[model samples]
Target: MHRPAVIALHYQNDILHPDGLIRVGLSEDDQKRTQLLVAAKKMLDGARAHGWPIIHVRVAYRHDYADLIQNAPILKSVANIGAVKEGSWGSDFYQALAPREDCFNEHVVTHKRINPFYDTQLCVLLRGLNIERVLIAGVATHSVVESTARHAVDCGFHVTVAADACASASSESHNHSLNSMRLIAEVSDVQSTLEALK
Candidate 1:
């Protein structure tokens, strides 16, 4: 059986583009992503019930665009990329998923390329805590969750993708990534993961 673990949930902001595209950016109070908010709460509730640690990773860039340009060159070249940058409505953590004042011992905020651990201290933090199993739930299943799952597995962590705690830009993208994850990691629902913790 796997040992006790911490959870990683990616909270991000969404933007309504003039061309009818919803851009993924930094999460803030105003963004209020309904699906991700529900997922975050579910993760927290599950973790609390089992006394597990929960770590939140938020993605944000710099307002000057220097950060993305320096770290994620491909995304920088893409036109009208959506990412939470400082001093913008898109940069704040969505209030709905915001941790209560005392839920976490520490937190991580970063501007990463796809994976939260990339160029970020997330891996080191998990290592320091001796975490070998991770329950992941977050926005854009094909993006953050998928990216992290790959790296987590490579790093030797038993990874579980909470399906109910995640969503994508479209249903197709969601299913596609889930299928991909099944080959790399375990894919489960909120209840199943909760049961495992129990």
Candidate 2:
């Protein structure tokens, strides 16, 4: 069995925080939000225990929004609300799942697009680490999570999405994305993935 790199996408405050802007599909219920956090942390802890590489991905734009593509409404809103502005509180990772400073092996990938690899060093970093497979999980399972999974596959890396550890704008959205991803990647729960890491 090959060791897989864990790619955690868009767990930043701007997306998952209760006060954060992009709130439509994020877990609104207290119980549901807590469960998502716990599941995400569990997978990260499991990766750390096994010495697997963990990559935390975030999306942020410049103050002037010059770096933003200005193509989609969501992208436009980011600029309007000044969301995920670099060095802003909204850009920071959520407290619970933020990467530890002492963890030398933990990596961070900052991107402007939904796909973490685009115009980012994610692919080079994975290649340099000799990574062949990736375990992906993140907020809005229908967006960044699914987009990155598809990109990872095209990059020739075997992709697996940790289904339970991910959330979407709605349950239907999450399920639909997973079903679409199933054609190109393996979609499984976090526990099973951790066991596979062993």
Candidate 3:
């Protein structure tokens, strides 16, 4: 059996919280689409119950924004909004979806880019754990989730995405990303992923 780790990507307040800075720009319907805390909580519980390694991936930049690359439109918007600064509340993981201390050797990986694997120690950590497969759940399904899943496949790790545990700016974008990822990764809901892990 493949040893799988659960990588929860970018559950930061700036992205998922109701009062997040980015929320100021999102539509009400978009806000509704981001109601992922409950589903993420369930996924975490299942992963913990099965003793699967849980990795939390967050994106945060230096206080002076020196480490931030504003090449991308989304990143430029992030800088303009003053979101996700290191040590800021907006950069912290959403409380309910945070990894518990008792969770199976929980790991936290910070990245400055959308793809968690880029310029981060995520792959090294997974390799150290002998992880052969990864189950991903996170916010902005069309961005981080899709980017990371594609990179994971290139890195020779089997990927599974917990569909219900991921959210995006809107349902259409979310589903579109999921459909695209289906070509290279297994797409399953939280319950199905949990059951398979069990």
Candidate 4:
């Protein structure tokens, strides 16, 4: 009955798209990027088909970067490159993954930090939807993707990561993060996640 919601993170131009300023933070290889987007689309489409609540999450900051927290090299790099500026093209979701305005079952969340739940309506939204288990995937497997998944587990919901739908700067880092997540969260492929959603 699609009890678990699906959270899609950082499918924005600044992270996932080929022209993104931070695309290298995920992967610069055409094969890896294509594989990620294709797998993510499959997961999203499968979830949507089963009527699962879908949350599209992205990281964006004001033009002046007032809301950004420069606490790390990568965090500071966001401002240096002027990436993901709120309402700018780079901050917009990738064309194919953008949620339709008319989709009532989907929501969009924009955060200023690597973790989407901090100071965001994510938890509240999940509670309102009566969701207790979540399926998640995103860019930079060791960063926002890992952060959000860990928090979801701490929040007491059962967590499952769609491994194939996530990407990172390198294979080693991505696998390392997944291994770390396995300690607290379930790690599964997109097909497995889709089957569960069904």
Pairs of residues clashing in candidate 3: none
Error of 1 at 146 (Å): 0.5
Tens-digit lDDT track of model 4 for 65-132: 98887999988999999999988989999988888777789999888877899999999999999998
The runs of at least 3 residues in candidate 1 whose Cα sits more than 4 Å from the true structure, single-residue gaps closed, are 1-3, 15-36, 70-74, 77-82, 104-106
Candidate 2, residues 77-150: lDDT per residue as tens digits?
77887789899888999988998888888999999987888999999999988899999999889888998998
Candidate 3 lDDT over 1-198, as tens digits, reads 866899999887887777887743344455444446667888888888788899999989988899998999999998998999999999998888887877657999999988989888999999999999999988788999999999999999999999988877677998999999999999999888888877
Better of 1 and 3 by lDDT: 3
**Candidate 2 deviant stretches above 4 angstroms:** none
TM-score on alpha carbons, each prediction:
0.80, 0.95, 0.93, 0.95
Candidate 4 residues lying further than 4 Å off, grouped into runs, are 25-29
Best by lDDT: 4
Q: Per-prediction count of colliding residue pairs?
A: 5, 1, 0, 1
Task: Rank the models by lDDT, top first.
Answer: 4, 2, 3, 1
Candidate 1 lDDT tens digits, 4-57: 465555553333221212344423342334545565677777776676766777
Mark the 10 consecutive residues where model 4 has the least summed lDDT.
24-33
